[model samples]
Target chain A: MAYNDKVLEHYEKPRNVGSMDKNDLHVGTGMVGAPACGDVMKLQIRVNDAGVIDDAKFKTFGCGSAIASSSLVTEWIKGKTIDQALSIKNKDIAEELALPPVKIHCSVLAEDAIRSAVDDYRKKQKGGVNASGS
Target chain B: MNRVDVCWSCRGGVVAGEGFCPTCRVIQPPDPRRDHFHYFGLNPGFDLDLGVLDTVYRQRQQQFHPDLFVSRGATERRYSMEHVTRLNEGYRTLKDPLTRGEYLLKVTGFREQTPENATPSDPAFLLEIMEWRETLEEVDLKGKNAAMQLQQLRDRMMETCDAEVVTLGKGFHDWFVGGKREGLAVAAQHTDRLRYFTRFLDELDRKSELFF
Candidate 1:
């Protein structure tokens, strides 16, 4: 399928395609998958002491739409607070990317990844122990 | 597609599935709505017996072989061809554990290609996958005893896959018998993990072929 200009650009130059130290108490990691398509994604975020997300990164092994969706979300969440980042929705991502109807799931996957990473972060805070990394 | 209840050839009561018409010996067209298990009259759980599946497959093949229709009408020939294609496809899918599990999910409310934002909610499983990838990357396949090393790792992976298959089988049993949604979810997670392992195994095989 021919992706729109925005999706194409993001796919071509996907931003923050890497991993943060999962063991860091300030870092939260999320791993998600679409079993239907065998697509797996890992998204991570580093939060500051003030509860603001200082940075975000991702590594996704999936189709172009999936890659672009995760890339866009990482960029969007970088400067936002945890609560603000959780407010981000899949619809906005799909609209910005102009994703096809079938690939709307890619946007949903990105949104879930963000929530999961933040959830990991919160869990670690409550438990007072690092569980993401060895 | 609608389910056929009568034999097209003899106006006899046909089996409620896409299997061949028993009365007139006519090969029926494949029913898209019927799952592989229903097509073969097998249970929908994961604890399948290949011996039984093979027996049924061979019986179907013998009854509907395309050669049996060479002297028949064009319609008969077409039905024969469809029968052969679908029967073989169903057998191949049901014979493999990973494919069978995925097929079960597809037939039971899950879309075969529906991309969902929900990931398998198991952190330990995620960690295991990451470690596997790391170990695979760390292997030096060009060094001495590389072949043996690779063989050892392949064996280990297969062992894990087999264990996961058994786990998924019990999960399927629980879902069907106890009607637990949690059981289905566990089976789904195991199925997802199995898919990843299958892909990794295929990649490793390709790499080994190159090495040799």
Candidate 2:
């Protein structure tokens, strides 16, 4: 299937493609996978004291749509508040990337990753001692 | 794909797997309702005897061979083709452990549990999958020991995949034979793992081609 130019762009030169110290309290890691297609994505965000996402990173192993979805989210989430990031829907991502109907799930996976990362961050904030990597 | 009980030619009541209409002697269309197991006259369960499946497949293939229906009416010929097609599909699905497990899940109404984005609920499992992918990323394909490194990784992934298959079989057995509903969930998880492992293996194979 032919990918849109935007998807190909993010896929070929994914931005902020890396990892953060999961042990860091400021870092929230979101790991998600697609069982039907065997695609895995790890999206992370570093939130500042004011609850603003200052940095985001991701590593995805799958098709171009999946890679592009995660890559696009990392770029979009930076500087946004956690609440703003939470409001980011998969449909928006799919539209931004011009994802096909079949690949909409890739965007959903990205959305799930971001939500999980935010949830992890919130859990850490609520339970400082009992957070992950403790 | 409905279960056709009456012969299209003579409209005679046809029993399941009766092959020819009792009155018209025309080949009946395969019952769409009959699942892969039922297609082979086997009980709907996880554990299956390959030898029995093979024998039954061959026997049915001969009994419903499309060539035998060439002189029959258009409906009979179409029915022969449909029967052969379903038979081939059933055989393929039942012959493999993974596909068979998947088919059983579909037949048993657990299909929704493994949708397109049905990732495992456990973070640790995703973490392990991420580590495996990261390992593949870390390996320098152009390095002198790249082939060996890739080989080792492939072997380890294969072993893990095999273990997952074993777990899947046990899970299916518990659900289909031992009457445990929770076994379906376990089987679903392993099925997801198998799907991931299969794709991972395919990726590894593609990368290994770089060595050539």
Candidate 3:
């Protein structure tokens, strides 16, 4: 039950905690949940014209570990390319947060959220309104 | 507890429904390996007759009463303790609809936890969750109509959760009775929804507390 200092720190003062225009073409939304713990997380990234993550935000409803996990990832993904953001592993987040073995799933949820967000962005770019029917 | 067919003390054959060995009249340990339905001597499925379950539970409780073992041997007393423990635990698990479905899923070889990809695949469900969460955050606790609004939301959420439970039951029935594999996935998805709904209700309770 005891959380590490880093987790507590991020949880108490989560950075970039908000929402973006999900309908905007540049915005990618990732919604993930852990059924076992009943935790829901929504992570979003707004990619700039340069194909770099201009801003990232998240809203998580769960334990401190979950909130910290998403909060940390949102901060990490900012200014990075979508590919770079995709490379952020759950292990790295868990290691950085010093999350306990049981809380490792929180980090995994964050990683999945990022991947999902990126996938959404790619899908939007591919066949949606952006498609020119080539 | 592992010796289901043979008695530990008398080494005699133990018949089904016989708590004590027929040959030596010694209490036999309850089989720990037995599934909950098997423990209750019922068919494994989602739909259960609560009356039958209640009757069996009461009968087993009386048969394995701890007081009945006090005058018996040390081994018999130990077996009695084990029987009562597992009986209570099993009865509690099977008595609840949600827990009962989950237990059936476990016995049917479904993973209890989420997989490596913990994110829910259903975008619609995710959007609903997010919107509900946003609504929860948007409610002003200091407003005069806050209590009424909270009650309305709670009622709506409770209705949704009740529907999910029904769907979950049907999913289990389809898998166990109808012999459909896809039913397992349906049960799993609804179970996930129920958990989220439960959490949302808990948050509602917290918000109500803050309002009051």
Candidate 4:
């Protein structure tokens, strides 16, 4: 269980760990869990009207792998366009973090969280309404 | 270093040549005997309440966990590690019906893999399994009505599995406490059925993801 020094550093002092205002229409929040490990993760994105990710935050409760995965994603998503952010796959995250095979699920969880948050933002835009505070 | 033999019954020191201590008439032995159930303070049975077992397991883990002996001597630390490891192995094996049944068979010195004794007595049960498999395969082929059917089957199978587990628990009590050794064989048979059923359920779950 010797993690990369960078991964361990991020896991211990995770950046962008918090929540966005639920009332913000451009803010998208995603909460997901892995049943196998009983781990939960929440990823949020604040997107501008032009579909550009302006800010990102996350809260994760799980193993070091999970924490590092979500922290990496939050850093990856900020300042990217919706399309660019969507292209960030779990495999890429796993590769960058050098996640072990068993912990690849943590990367997959991060990918799903990003997709869920972006999808929520798109849904709100389609409905021409404010965020539902879900 | 001088060696001293201790009597089991009297706790009195005995000479090396002496077979038994005069005070208690107890023979000196190097190792103490321990039974699995007695070690865990449980009556050996087929049936167990997993919730209660979980609590007991955590409590015992707290008592014997290696983390608690981080500052202890090397010998004491090694002893604690070995004790906790065995406890974990025993708890895991005894918690599952299939493993428990296999353990009971091993304890009773029945090592043969008897396929003749494998099949369940209930023909309808086998038929039900076949039907579920057929439905699963059909769904895989057609890819329609899968979600609803899978959900229904999952719910029903889960309920049935829970009930069967409860019955297995009662069977354990019957075999271990009631002195009905024959019941152990019956419990083992049911455990086999439960194992197959669990595998099928897992297959269905994996197949369900295909539709999604």
How would you order the candidates by TM-score, starting with the best? 2, 3, 1, 4
Question: Of 2 and 4, which scores higher on DockQ?
Answer: 2
TM-score of each: 0.77, 0.90, 0.89, 0.45
lDDT of every model, 2 decimals: 0.82, 0.88, 0.86, 0.70
Total clashing pairs for each candidate: 0, 0, 0, 3
For B37-83, candidate 3 gives per-residue lDDT tens digits of 88888888878898999999999899989898798889888888888
lDDT of 4 by residue, A1-134 (tens): 69987689889899898878845778887666553343556788999877789999987756788899999999999999989999999899999999888888888889988987887677767656443543
| Candidate 1 segments exceeding 4 Å error | A1-14, A126-134, B1-7, B10-35, B41-44, B105-115, B137-152, B174-185, B202-209
Flag clash pairs in model 4: B46-B172, B47-B169, B47-B172
Residue range B8-58, candidate 4, lDDT tens digits = 456788754333367865333322233344445565566566777778778
- In lDDT terms, which candidate is top? 2
Model 4 — TM-score against the truth?
0.45
TM-score of chain B of 3: 0.82
Docking class of predicted structure 1: acceptable
Specify the poorest-scoring 10-residue window by lDDT in model 4 chain B: B112-121
Better-scoring candidate (DockQ), 1 or 4: 1
Candidate 3 chain B, which ten residues in sequence have the lowest lDDT sum? B111-120
Give interface RMSD, every candidate, in order: 2.6, 1.5, 2.2, 16.3
In order, the first chain's TM-score in every candidate is 0.94, 0.95, 0.95, 0.92
Which stretches in model 3 have alpha-carbon errors above 4 Å? A128-134, B1-4, B112-116, B206-212
List, for all models, the DockQ compared with the true complex: 0.36, 0.75, 0.60, 0.01
On TM-score, the stronger of 2 and 4 is 2
